[model samples]
Target: MGFRDIAMFNDSLLAKKAWRLLKNPKSLFNKVFKARFFPNYTIMEAKHTSGGSHTWNSILHGRDVLLRGCWRIGNGKAISIWQHHWLPRKHPPQVLSPMVDSLADAKVAILIEETSRQWNHEMIDGIFTPMEAKLVKAIQLSRYEAEDSLFWPFTNDGIYTSKSGYRFLKAEDQSEVEEEQRANLLRLNKTTISSHQIAATAKERLAEFALTIPRPQYPRVASTPFQTRWLPPSQGLVKINCDDATFKDQKKSGIGVAIRDENGMVLASMAKHLRQLYTALEIEAMAPSTALTFATQVGFHNGILESDSLVLTTALINNSTYLSTDGLLMEDIRFNASYFNQLLYSHVKREGNKVAHKLVRHALCILDFSVWMEDVLPPIRSAVLDDIVGFS
Candidate 1:
């Protein structure tokens, strides 16, 4: 993208105007443009007239540059699930499945739960293949109501900058050059480039890059790190420790919860092997939810819900806002905890959560969710003893 040629540079600048129109339809300039050129449709849908003005022609050129843009899905009301570029993970970035006649012209909102702003999992599974369903479920909806917006993904802020637009042009140009050279020059026994070199060369724009800075001064102070050890709850309360792990190779996730009395004796524990995978933060939030239910089922109305996840512990304790699918998960966690007569969220380091960690690891050997009552499982015997010994 360095030193964009005159033609592409102008196109990049024009693309900025297009972006502004899409970002701020309420702006006077955008409103005027829309009324004149595309009254019934969006700028993207605007057609070329028999004799359009130069300004309109330039905007269309910029709109061509915007073909690479995608929608950062929110309410999904305006986005077509089958037609729009919404699925971030897929190649071509749209639903590959043919539109069902029964649900023709359906908006992306159809796949979402209107009340909760969450994916309709059963509907997703019904509409898509297993792989597609996984991708759809993985997309976290905004916690609060948010409208769909088009954005360029190449830039950090998701706003289309002239620089990013220029980079797209430069990359496209480089690819065409390489293709022509390989087809014509390489076959004639001319100087040839390796496939690896071709890509590196095409993408290489920076000749020299470095940071000019001074090294930091050394600190003489020394400190001791906190050692992690599980703490017992007060009398008449059980403390439940929660942890979770994701297995990418196996395409699954697991959660472990251990409920112990003030004496550090395990009252009940659970290891669940989920059939589906979730993001780390989502799983972390879910772990506490599972723990709450496990303790409640055992008739423990008062307990300390503990975990190594500081994000969740702080969030639950503060009842703060978190922005997406994990936010929804936190809601469920607190909802489950509502069943407890007395509840608390506490955080500890990994060493203190060894029992829960080991129990979740044991989940790999199992097929589905499992729970233990009135006994310590063999896989986590050592971890349970460690906590008990620490308690004493």
Candidate 2:
């Protein structure tokens, strides 16, 4: 019943982003990353610089899929004749014929008529084999000098979607995926994951578990419902609690985020109202990226991110099954995640996520987005105080 690999799905999701980088040269994401990683080169020609991120490495690994896709030549100035995949119906989507020494480093622009925007048949014949010349002449040139773009032949519309990319990756590299990755699981459960970066969660859960063991039948004393309330992060790490609200009638949604330090004091809180209709599930899924972005904006580079949405929390985990369930959403989530030094995704019950929920309830008063520093909104003030007072 199951046949997909998490690693391959991860690659598939990241693969489609190559097209984004190629298409939108001026986007903020492209400008920031391109300046640091690629610098004055097209994404197709970009190399991994030393001291780059693991996320960047994983993204480049997916470029092979994009490499196999052919460029639909238009201006052709953007595409390389020899290195890029532009030839039609070829297995490698490039000229199989050996390149002549003179044309070794050329752009497809040189093979086209300047004003007419048509292929130069004479040039094609002189440079390539007869078969290659025939195929080159057969490819239609755009009349309007439209920009060059990549196309995946495996897809009917010549566009790449994560689902299609996943299927393609599964067929292309079955041997590379491991058994555990296929199951979307981890063996960390049986092992003690000791790391200083980890929030003090293991001990908390272990202490809670100690309360439930059958051997502990001492005089029954009343206990605070700490398990049902918001908890602070480990001593140094901050925690961001995220939640969402949906309006069915007006068809608008709201997102709320509460960022707090290990001392349980509110560092910042965000409430933004959406003008468009969205389902509860969709809005909940939107919370993590919003929260992470807010954290980055406010200068918190690393922390614990808690959410009531099990789907999102699990999806945020590496190689988790829910990750593949919403590949595109997680793609954006992972993109935002790379902005952090260390971030941990934690799943909390709805009861523990009240502060953010309260902020969502207060979203109706705000127009687009509202953020408060070193304070809580009046609606969530009580919740924040209670949380701080309750912390052990």
Candidate 3:
């Protein structure tokens, strides 16, 4: 079996065990509690209670790892602003100093305007530090007025998984590497950018930097409407349609990419959430970058890439120019696009790309990035089916 099959099989086995040990009330150990198992709240809250059976002790032992990647979504009533990890940005939203006594015990709801059901900007501005205030302002209010809820940051379905947990822990190593790279880049910048050069022609240098970057071998083909319908890839090829959804208020966005066979049957898909970004177009540009990365990793050679972003489409077709920071990103995109032995880029209208759009929206609410092969996620299944039906 392939990697995808192995991953699915392992996940299936884990899901089955999780259901039995955690959700099945009829299980002997669950019967001891006389209640359903709650890994996050109930069991975790009772951590100090004198332990019971081996199973319960084992579950408690694993809680620490699980809790590391989980965060609370505050609805105001059920979670305290200061006590809980309600803000999704960090493990616990960083506060350099403790809050004043007046607001020490305040509920997250206090920051919500009762009538508007949104953040009370005045209250937030008056109380929080600038950084904290920005984070608070970016938070999306609870729409259903539901109590605080636990979110698993490692899974697309908001369900916990060992793979996600490992990924969460692995990020620390990646961060360290990134930090070192950033420091080196800063040192280079300081050494290379002379005072005369900085004053002489900043635009000229910027343009030079943009053009100096090497690009892929993909021909500079202007993006044209290939097939407006949900057409599949040609035989022996895969079509990857990618889209990005931005949640400006939440300071987050998601990338949705779907890969399909010539029959229009989905082979794999991804919905990945990222921290809030500067521009939607930047994120849009990322769709192709991500798609190409996944394609090359999976050993796909011939592919056609589709996106709804005209800006990204144009950038890829035309020669690089120092228009903005996006020019740098476009250079990277072009370099990656060359990985496929035969790759083509196309632009499609939003209507023809609903499946990818839906996938991106679904990604926004998820805690971690998700990838599916063979089995499509429930949210995007209908969208996938709709595309297939259109071919009929």
Best by lDDT: 1
Candidates 2 and 3 compared: the better one by lDDT is 2
lDDT of each model, Cα atoms only?
0.81, 0.76, 0.66
How well is each residue in 208-277 modelled by candidate 2, as lDDT tens digits? 9998987845798898764777888987789999998887777678999999988888999999998766
- Model 2: lDDT equals 0.76
lDDT ranking, high to low: 1, 2, 3
> Which one wins by lDDT: 1 or 3?
1
Pairwise TM-score winner, candidates 1 and 3: 1
TM-score of each model, paired residue for residue: 0.58, 0.44, 0.43
Query: Which clashing pairs does model 2 show?
Result: none
Q: Residue 238 lDDT in model 2?
A: 92
Candidate 1 achieves a global lDDT of 0.81
For residue 288, give model 2's deviation from the true position in Å. 0.7
The segments of candidate 2 whose C-alpha lies over 4 angstroms from its true place after superposition are 1-227, 321-326
Q: Write down the TM-score for model 1.
A: 0.58
By TM-score, the candidates rank as 1, 2, 3
